[model samples]
Target: MGFKSKRKIKTNFVSAANKKLRLAWDRKHRQLTVSDWRKWVFSGKTRVNMGGSDSESFYWSDVPGTNRPHQVRPQVQGISDGVMVWGCISGDRPGYSTAIIDGAIDSNKYVEILKTSLMQTLE
Candidate 1:
């Protein structure tokens, strides 16, 4: 006779997230109005923020072999480059897509971009 494999029984457990989502659905179901939607659209105060970032590696790595371990030397090829873009939009108004070119986005650089690009976009 063949031995039967022991399998775990599946459980349908409702987590805290499921409870919260169900409550939110129950509260918001057919409760929104046209005026509420219009206000939300015009205010541009949505729950989501739009943002993006791009990066490029300046150094290359040698392919690793599974047979044995090897020590690799690091090389200074060039500067690590990257850029970040972000913006928001309202119903009729368009937003600005600001891009900052830097290796790291610190507070000082962030403020600089806001002062330069963001201010220009606002104007």
Candidate 2:
């Protein structure tokens, strides 16, 4: 409800198949918690607090300087060609490093990374 973001795009949740999947996941989570699938021996709610984070980096190549005249040619800098790297961290565990294809990432590509690298870190 109130968790909706200001920049959110409106969509029909009831008509979305993904909504059913999310609901199923929530149901499983609730079931496991109820059945004590993971026993809480610690006094606090969180014993070893589990967290995950990921980041992306770009590496740019340096361009060589030219001896052309200053007034005749505009100032030129390095080319925009770069490689992107994605990595994640979870407590002491680290996920595998991934290279984004051509500085572009879509839903399918992101899911593949999650399934491989991110999943390993989580496990």
Candidate 3:
């Protein structure tokens, strides 16, 4: 057998309603021209993991031996340490981003980010 160990790919579960909404959104925007798209700024937020990920690892070896330092992953003490960041970009240029200094972003924080980063990007 020519099988090798591999890590499982993680994926998010999309609900049927979410799928329908995405399809509808695509249909609505499918007719938009390049200039129309250029006028749009796509924005999103993600967590930048400061610590190592909590995922399984695999290695190949002909004989069983002690695990090397590189083979072992560090275990974080608490919740995965990471900082949340928000950014936006247009068709022509990248935009500014800000780290969530205090906590998770709320509606107010989102508006503030839009007022600062998004406004600067548009200008």
Number of the top TM-score candidate: 3
**Alpha-carbon RMSD to native, per candidate:** 11.5, 14.5, 3.1
By TM-score, rank the candidates, best first: 3, 2, 1
Per-residue lDDT of candidate 1, residues 11-75 (tens digit):
76899999999999879855876655534321112112122222222333465453322343333
Clashing pairs for model 3 are none
Question: What is the model-wide C-alpha lDDT for candidate 3?
Answer: 0.86
For residues 29-114, could you state the per-residue lDDT of candidate 2 as single tens digits? 77565336433221111112112112232233354454435323232355433445667644344556776645466677778877
Kindly list the per-residue Cα lDDT of model 3 for residues 1-123, writing each as its tens digit.
Answer: 999766677898999999999999999999999999999999999877777554556666666677777667776586647888999889999999989967799999999999999999999
Local accuracy by lDDT, each model: 0.51, 0.51, 0.86
Clashes per candidate, residues 3 or more apart or on different chains: 0, 0, 0
Scored by Cα lDDT, where does model 2 land?
0.51
- TM-score attained by model 1: 0.32
Please, what is the TM-score per model? 0.32, 0.35, 0.74
* Model 3 spans with C-alpha error above 4 angstroms: 1-5, 59-67, 75-80
Q: Name model 2 segments beyond 4 Å from true.
A: 1-80
